[model samples]
Target: MAAPAHTFTHDGIAFGGDYNPEQWHPSVWEEDVALMREAGVDLVAINIFGWAAVEPRSGEFTFASLDRVIELLHAAGIRVNLGTGTASPPAWLTLAHPEILPIAEDGTTRYPGGRQAWCPSSPAFRTAALSLVRAVAERFGSHPAVALWHVSNELGCHNALCYCDQSAAAFRRWLRARYNSIDALNAAWGTAFWSQTYSDWDEILPPRAALSARNPGQALDFHRFSSDELLDYYRAEAAVIRDLSDVPVTTNFMVAAHIENMDYWQWAGEMDVVANDHYLDYRLGDPRTELSFAADLSRGLALGSPWLLMEHSTGAVNWQPINFAKSPGQMLRNSLTHVARGADAVCFFQWRASLQGSEKFHSAMLPHAGTDSELWREVVELGAILSKLDEVAGSRVVADIALVFSWESWWAADAESRPSTAIGYLDQVHAVYAAFAALHMTMDVVAPGADLSEYKLVVVPGLHLVRNEEAAIINDWIADGGTALVTFFSGIVDENDRVWAGGYTGPFRDALGVAVEEFAPLAPDSRVSLDSGATGTKWSERMRVTTAEVVDAFADGPAAGSPAITRNRWGSGNAWYLSTLLEPEEYRSLALQLAAEAGVDSPVRVSGDAEGAVEVVRRRGDLASYVFAINHSNTSVQLQVSGTELITGDNNAGHNTAGHNTAGDNTVATVEVPPGAVRIIREESAS
Candidate 1:
């Protein structure tokens, strides 16, 4: 695969945000360019929503505005992440071809007023969209300012699952390719239960609105087909770019809390460089933990390589029901945290805040207040800070633990007929990840069936759907001495959405040495006590012991006196099973106990008059190693290390936050980390 576009002049972290000069007049363009220079902005994305602008009429094309914007940025030494402008369709095309509009699951047409309103299977839309892509690529493919080819802006964000007739035809074609024949598809879909058997390909349809609960097998396949369709569309756009340009190609992946539409692992191999757009979703509290999880996940999609943060927010975002602006240094803290986890570039959703449109109130690098605001000051300071860590680019994050993240599990667990409405796959993953975060442990987020050989410890939480081979790999790894933590609702089904037959914990029963007799999903806001003196919520299971030792049992609830937690000595290593979701603190305590057994350790520790938490992560390169200490609290803390501090540019410019201490590579080197400050240390081997 090709490397990511590294176009900044100083060889430092790439900086800047989405820039739309067409939204303003040429008079404002000069000022915007000057401000970009003043803030040290080196990268800016243009023509992201250029579908309507570039091709205003069906066959008519205009490059006057786009050409001028690129010329201005190029003149100012800013490299471009150019968009193909197929993000959304223009009003004329949709009016001319109404069949291209997407249909909701409830059989409603998603109009073209919003972005991403076209159906993925519509040939009319694809032809028009691909034509626009070709026009953009042909015009600017060899342009000096163009550093990267952005295919489409956030594909599948608005229309992943469409129930139109075209989608049904496309679904049948995809099914034929996967299952090969009608008999094979029937076996996989388990159609006999509801008299839903298909005699031929044409008989099958996209799982549309139903009288009762939809078929799990059908629903699961539709989700898979939807993700595949979007990936296929992206591949087509990428093909156009590759034929015309050598610039690395990428489209921003919505790998955030609200999106689970795309199985990004399948799409990773197709990208030249993986990029992601992330925003703070207040629905999931503790923005710090949520931010780390998202950044780490983006890295995971890149296969642990350095990735670009294509979109974040400077302050409040406009989409959320209750948007909250970042408090004080939060903007800086959020940017650095992404860097701490291995983001080589930091960019936000926009450069200038919009004056009109759905995103009008969305914060940007340059707010509506222009350069006079404190937001602009913070943006400039962040730009300077990023420039100081030039050498930190291209380094890989260090991790010893692996967390299995499966989109299949997410799809299956979230369907309508699950045991509990509260057993959310992402929620469970976040809850378990928060446990690791509480212990200040950095972990690798891996997909199902990933090699566990490199990791000392593996964490599997809420893995509701596991293929036979995936289960076998984990079983083999554990028997070969890899420690693991497998939680509830895991190993329940195979690739076909069919049960594993023997017990609740299906293919994992042998490795886990425990049998889940039945699922006992609890009521909402419910609680159950465990023998370990910890309270559990969300779910509990009736289980029996085989070779596994019962570590904790239920004290009350449906499965009273049953095992709540189990530990099995499988071969040379250990496998622990959690039957219920424990409170955050208790979960972290148990995770630490397992970590101690696995010999996982972090060199850094934090304790002081600190008011908030400090996230510690390290990146390793052949020539140098660096530690990132990000303080997210209210009071200052001390980071003692023997290295050169990048921000202050001293031999060891440690902090005096804990009263006072010298900063040196030898003894007495203490760096005081002010609350909500970021410190990067280039370490010495001798220390």
Candidate 2:
């Protein structure tokens, strides 16, 4: 793959993670440093929660211990990513300024039991946070070892919507900025339907249970407003840090964190580099579903910029009722998956496990047993491997397909009472994603307003909340000969979750050439067969083709004979409507068929006999392309390669049962991979 437009140099994939030396005695500091060296640790992110220690009272400051930690790491040749200790507030500040504690939506003030309990919109919290941030930056901004500045650890607030008076005032201001005038706001919110129109901004408050009815429009706006408010808080802290520090600043974001409405695209603009904390449930079929999705999201957020794997557990997390170890090769495979996706570096949640506090049981490189544990050995081995694979750092993945995933539309759709209670926003989108994954097709998950001209095919599934401008963009794309595949429950509502009144799909009715008169919710076990000899699973929408050709319909329902799939030709493009939820096989077959028609290339075609766990991603460049063939299963499987394996430092002469043989060695080889193995091959020539 071609290197990114901007080159960032790191010795190798960044190792080491949240390192807190404050809990340990000074005598153990030497041991910690030695252990880090043994494990090939190079970067140490320090002082993530030292607000109380840094400033005990209003303006009192002390940095004696912190200064020593910095000096020690610097002298040891270790890079530092300094953190502003603003995630937690001192007890005194919370006690004196009770407003600093977040107020729940139910009008209850939260007690300080956990981290991330501070109210984002609270002026008192912001003031105290800024004081400590400015102090930390001034002291360590120019430190020779510091490479980056981490602001506020994991900025997701537990109490997402603060119904406090301060938040109430902010919500009003946010609404004004969005609508510009009360008349437009009234129309957008459909306030005329329920006598809910606002005469003045002062009268508006957050859509709390006490002041509002269960209106989807009201609820949707509140979500948008709350997200904006939290973003403002993040920006406030970042502004203070940037003023005092020359180093790049960033904070860890949870990828699927929906309540925050933090447009990763917008958030990435303020950050020097994007970072995220990803945790997975092994039972969720395949970790690749969530892992690859997040990586794509992060890459898109950075506009193809590399991201940081901020946190992953070295062992099992105690928080989950049943703490399970990442079975043998699981951790290694998961970590490599991140690097393969586009992460510049990989790090875990902690270096040493804490002896006290809620996260004490969390996994670490140096476990509670001190050292010499299996977990520690694995960490060391992985770190050694990263030291060797430094060339892959800063490489980019070139993709031809883009999947449209709009957070705003997702939030708005779920906010309303839809036709099917079973039709969840994430699940519907994941269905389409699962189809693409099953076909082993590389897809770029993009936001609403991303440039679509580069992509030959775009798949938009269940786009229920079509904001005003989005329709025009889609229309233009279709008019320009772009092929778009849209599924059921699309183009039903505007930005605020209000039903588009002109027709079922207001602005898109003509483009789709279909009118959805009624929607039918399917039972959990219900099934429907399409006229194209394809079966559908769960949920179907009944609609008529106004100007398009119907290819399929429901086998049974009140509107059983109605169109289930439609195809229309607009300008130079073709628009397809999937009026019902499709079975996995059906969705995959249709997606691949459409992709073929659009002239998009499908790389890495695995034969039927090839089994066990496997994944493939292609990275293209002007001159040549690189294909990554990874075997995530326990047993080996055969694979065809046209070039060499970068990881094993081998040359591929031909397929072997034991996998590709190494250079300068004569060994019979088959693509027989052991559990959790990876291979990187560069295409001999571009297609």
Best by lDDT: 1
- C-alpha TM-scores of all predictions: 0.96, 0.92
Of the candidates shown, which would achieve the greatest TM-score relative to the real structure?
1
Give lDDT per model, in order: 0.87, 0.75
- Prediction-by-prediction clash tally: 8, 9
Q: Model 2, 1-687: lDDT tens per residue?
A: 212222224676788788898888988888888888888888888989888888888899999989988888888888888889988888888889988787776788888878777777788888888888889988988888988788888775465667788888877788888989988888877788777888888887776665544667767888777766766777787777777766777788777523335555556666678787777655454556767777777777767767888887777876666777787766777787777777878888899999999889888878888766778888888888778666666667767778887777777666635566666777777778777766667778777767788888888877788876877787788889888888877788877677888667677788888898887767877777777778776667667888888878877765589888888888888888887778777887888878887887556555334342476677654555666666766666555446556666666623433433444455443343445776666666654
In candidate 2, stretches whose alpha carbon ends up further than 4 angstroms from where it belongs are 1-9, 210-213, 257-260, 282-287, 321-323, 608-612, 620-625, 652-672, 682-687
Itemize residue pairs with steric clashes in candidate 1: 612-633, 654-670, 654-671, 654-672, 655-670, 655-671, 655-672, 664-669
lDDT of 1 by residue, 360-475 (tens): 99999999998888999999999999989889898899989999999889999998888888769987899888888766688899999998899899999989999889988998
Model 1: lDDT of residue 391: 91
